[model samples]
Target: MKFKSNILILVLLAVFIVCSVQSVSAANSHNFTTDDNFDTKFADVVNGDTFTFKAGSYNLTSDYLINKKVNLVAENEVIINSGDYRFNFASESNGSSVKGFVFLGDSNNPKATTPIATTGPTEDITINNNTFKYVYDGVSFGRYATNNFEFTNNIIDGFLRDALNLGGGSGHGDVYIVNNIIKNNLSAKDGIAIAYKGSGNLTINNNTISNVIEAISINSFNAPDLNATVIIKNNIFDNVETVIEDPNHSEIIDSYNVFNNSGESSLTHTPKEPANIIINSTISKSSISKDGSVNYTVKITNSGNRTADNITLTITLPNSLKYVKTISKTTGDYKNNEWTITALDAGSSATLSLTLNAKSTGKQTIKSSSSYLNGNETTPKEGQTTTILSVNKLSTKITVVVAKSAILGSTSKFKITVKDKNGKVLANKNIKVKVNSKIYTGKTNSNGIATVNAKISNKGKYNVKISFAGTSDYSASSKSVQHKVTASDLKIAGVKRIGKNYIVKVKNIGDISSKSTKVAISFKTDNKPGVIQYATVKVKALKPGKTVSVLVKFYINKIYSSHKRNVIIEESKTFKEASYENNIISIRK
Candidate 1:
């Protein structure tokens, strides 16, 4: 029994040891650190190896050749500082991938090389999650047949030439470039974000591209013989000169792409439609009085090479204006203030004019749009013109003035004077006094003076407008004045010190009378103790536009001579004034 147990323990220990050895060999098989010659180390790796590099910088002096199907992955931050070409994948290196590594080239001489270049026929090559910066060309592939190539989730920036240049030659494959950010390749002639020339199926989806001369340039080498299919969708393109430059205009399916701040000529393609129609609308007058008529002209021109068939122009009028009649040639119905015209030819314009009467007083807009009746596949082009129709008020000369400046909560008399252009008074006319949308009506006397009384409560500048409706002899007019309702203001007019006696004059320049007002005079010496002298004089009542003098005597001391002294005349708090900022006067000695 002891010998059987010993044999069982030995078999278990041997199995455990074999498993441990295999685990260690698998871990060390495809892991590499930074070495002096990384290109040489990479060449020694076998086929189908998943080699991972540690976080460090590897300076590549010469181009590394990819001869077999392998994966070059970075564990963390790995950068390849290359001089010219970084990797040259041969025809036999099928299904190889390079991911999660940053490739940096010489910025001063960026036009000297590319980051990854494919020489011969390569199939199923994926370059993803890698950043290529300051390279001449980020990736250059073609000249031979390549199939099923994918370049996704990669960032290529600051390239002097094209970021992904797939040149023309014998090639039959589908090239997919998805979810990549390509920017700042500013070459005027050939610095495109993605350029394709050969006959292949190309798809660019969900990529962000900006700051390039051309975002995508597609040109077929042998046009009637070799045709390429391109599918571009869900990409954001900004700050690029041109979004697409398809010279041959191949079969392309493009939709749901966002383009902002790009050039005006975004898509350069041959039009498949019959005509391109442009509509323009103009008003005879931008502003007209109420019940006045305005002429609106809508010009529909077909600017395309082919004649437009069954083209329709629709004009929509605002509720403030009513359509009167059509003055020009029209072929459609005018109902519900909308005019429609049908049919415009190529390089010809159909001018339709309609007179509209101003119904109300405000700004009104006339909207007109035209479209080809063949289909609604394209958006209809629109144009608009705004007109302002005001009420036809007379243009008489009107003057609005307060009869006298009044106090708050007091009845103020406002006089409105209306005159015609010949300086004659318009008598027995109706005038309205509008104070902040509150209307007060009165009739002018024989002297053309309309008087209205209003209780002023708000203490601010009021825009008082006097309007005169037009009569048969005079035009309508309105004039406004900024009338200020203020409290009773008390001010010290003048101050004089004569023979140790201070005389102060107080005045009521405000519109109301003041009662029980006290004027005070005080002097202070600029010493450490600050000796002060004070006196007060009481005035029983002061009327508006009136003045009074108060006299106070103070004995001058030697302390007042040695140091600087200040004398101030101030009104007491018995009355509230309009402005207290100028109430006190200071005399410094």
Candidate 2:
């Protein structure tokens, strides 16, 4: 894009000099002009020259136009940076258009920011297989470039607003933009990446694009209705947004895509449709709300190109509302039809109704839901809908009661009873334990209550856990409560088998107080049929060394009636040094 139009005037005169990059295909040519001016080394040669571009930067503001059809390749690593700050290349009016060059431009242009525009109608100006870095505009197919070209496999990374633009005339230009990366930069004034305007066959396919203001636009807005049939398929518009608007040309056929669109205004789509949306069944409205003695009905219709069968409609209402359904069938029957909403289709409006009342007072909110089925359970097309009711003012009541106690014993039953507007138990409702695990477990009863039962096994100090969870929603209770269990609270209850089949006991035990210590009890003679002792009982006050006669019966015949077997009995106490005894008399027959 370096031809200034007027340069042909100077070259026409004998005084003008010409330089060409024709024989660039020769191997390993690092033939840099050792002279400050590279005029001698890079001048005049023509078509079919292959050259390689080495790894480095290039800055060219000089006017260098390809006047012949030549192949200028970027060798293993060739760089063209820093030159006469002007248009780098221009095609001779009718000479061959320059094709094939890996031109790496690093032009530090602070003023001229517009991408170099190709002038006039240039044909077969193929720009492919090159990596452009930090240039004014990577490459521009300027106004009216009717070139059947291939802009493929080029990585343009720079600071121009638009990495590429293909703006053509009405029903005129045909260009194929394929497989190129135009990213890593920004432009102030509509740096459109690719603006297609010509009325030509343009196929932009299979490439990655990112971070550009106007990434890809098929701008038929400026052109007459004679717009070009553009095919933009298989490309990623990652992190891009813009004015890509042609409501008329937005029908895209998509298949196998991972496309993410963040732009609110415009979007890009391919010409052929890959997937279409099929509505299983369509309803007149999404949802509705109603109050006292309300009736509403909608017609279910099939809105797809294909026929829908056996559509079922179900409605949900607030538990407060006692509803009556009057459908011809619980499961709807359908004929293969384009559209059919029974209520609206019935010449007049058919209706569905509900009879309702406020269960509680002072603003009640109830939600009813509904679902539609394909009528077949296994492959049913289903969706849910909900309606709500609001009561301005009403009367409501709740009752919480504790069940009557069974005679005061070691275990106390605490029942959490609840009643609705009416005093009736709604049994077997789930409740949570608001108290700590060490203290309580929210229990459920057959008669709709959360019963928290506590066993008092200690004496003296008492602590309480009040469980407040109830059985059901109507129960009106939280899963929280206060409880008091103490040493003096646990009944002095436990059994000791003094004689066979005789479980004798101690009395008057209460909530927990002092720590307990156990005194060992062992019978001097081992008895057959081993006896199992299940834990020791805590006794706060007991005679220390008194001969307490505890009856002993045996499974064996009671023999040796006089031989006194040493009977050992140990006692336990809290807050006292425990004393034991070997002085126990065996009462034998």
Candidate 3:
């Protein structure tokens, strides 16, 4: 009976120990869904806890702080739409991992949005198989320190500035970045920007980077160890402006990298007291007329820690502007559109001025690029700023000179002139004049005057229109002048007969001259109204209120002693007359 009882107790103890082990395992792992509150779940979790997020979308409005070691896993198709929020891993959050999750950020505030960041010293943080889009920064190595980080199999498609930023802090152990895709970013200046201060081994292998300005930019660290090394191998770089830009580090190893449409790799020795060049340009007039000129000023500065020697700057003038000459320069000489600076110390600046004539009229652009040397290191960095200039066309005025009143059947003369806004006459300009339903075209002479003539038939008020079609340097203009025209009248004034000679007088009774016409005289005998003899006289142009006399002789067929004769004078129809009653006269002889 005692042996059987001991066997039972041993069996029960074994079962109890097995149950305790299972319970601990269950407590360490937790499952969450999109409907659950992450804050509540995180508060009840302990170190080394595994939180598995179910397949759904999780919205986070604020930053989620992780102060203990944790492992976050995504079940399948997990999306975290964090609007301007990030996951903050604190100092104690070492040995933490974030895996297989998609993070979305508000692209509107990309400069201020970060997907994942570190607050203090963190180590052994693994961020793998994650997708980040529309974020300012993908991952941040803390400013204090970071070590033994693994960032692999991640797709960082879009970011405002940097995809991976090693925040100029001390880093230790090994950093493995493998088999990742970083592409389709226009606002990022550097793909993996590193400014590491500590000693470590960085490996970048089998990664694909494209469409970035600089695939990898390694700036000079503040105080880095001398024995640090960076190994870059077997990476595919395509369509990147620059493959790698590292000017201050010599401990980097690069091999077996395939480049297509990616610019050549640059590696230069570290320079002592490197120089930084800054260029700024401005125009005296943003908008000017085609006949005007503008002044351009370029101020160059050396804002680096040391002085720069033999700095060269080039200015590219657009087709809308022509370089006239150099006005003033504080230092350096300009030729062939290039400006040379012999030396520029740190924190010093120089000014250059030049006059540019507005050649064509439109929006003009001026571009400037520069290159400099520092301590036997010739690294050319291109910097540009577009300064817009607008050249406007000058306005013009048309002046017309004409008479207020003109005589009928006479030519009306018009004088048209064109001038600019500055009262400068524009020569050889085409002009159009419209008068009395006729259009006459002419060009202005050297004196800017054009003469046009039109015939006036009726007597009334009329408008004489003159227009100047502007040239490339001037604008169009038009003017109108009012004119009046009057008609003429002619009449026979008196008639006289002396011996066998007859004298006839014709007068113009209107305000203008009359055309050449004829006058006739007839003689009748006794009481009969039959004409016995006739004579005619010709008269030339008669002026206003003027009279002229002409003589005509006729021979009589038969002479009678007791005969009463009637003599008559009449005017011909060569021009219009006001009345016909005053054009004829009768007398007995």
Best TM-score goes to which candidate?
3
264: Cα error in model 2, Å = 4.9
Off by over 4 Å in 1: 1-29, 220-225, 264-589
State each model's CA lDDT, in order.
0.74, 0.43, 0.77
RMSD of 2: 20.1
TM-score of every candidate: 0.40, 0.36, 0.46
lDDT of 1 at 308: 61
Model 3: residue 108 alpha-carbon error in angstroms: 27
Tell me how far the alpha carbon of residue 124 in candidate 2 is from the true structure, in angstroms, after superposition.
Answer: 1.5
Q: Extract clashing residue pairs from model 3.
A: none
lDDT of 1 at 168: 63
RMSD of each: 18.1, 20.1, 19.5
C-alpha RMSD (angstroms) for model 3: 19.5
Candidate 3 lDDT tens digits, 136-157: 7878664656678888999988
Candidate 1 at 330: error in angstroms?
49
Name the runs in model 2 displaced over 4 angstroms.
1-43, 49-61, 82-117, 170-173, 220-226, 246-257, 264-589
Q: Between the candidate structures 2 and 3, which one is better when assessed by TM-score? A: 3
In model 3, the runs with Cα more than 4 Å from the true position are 1-274, 374-377, 397-407, 421-428, 445-449, 482-486, 490-509, 515-589
lDDT of 1 by residue, 403-501 (tens): 535666567788888876557787899988887868888998999899988776665678788788786434678887777776776777888878767
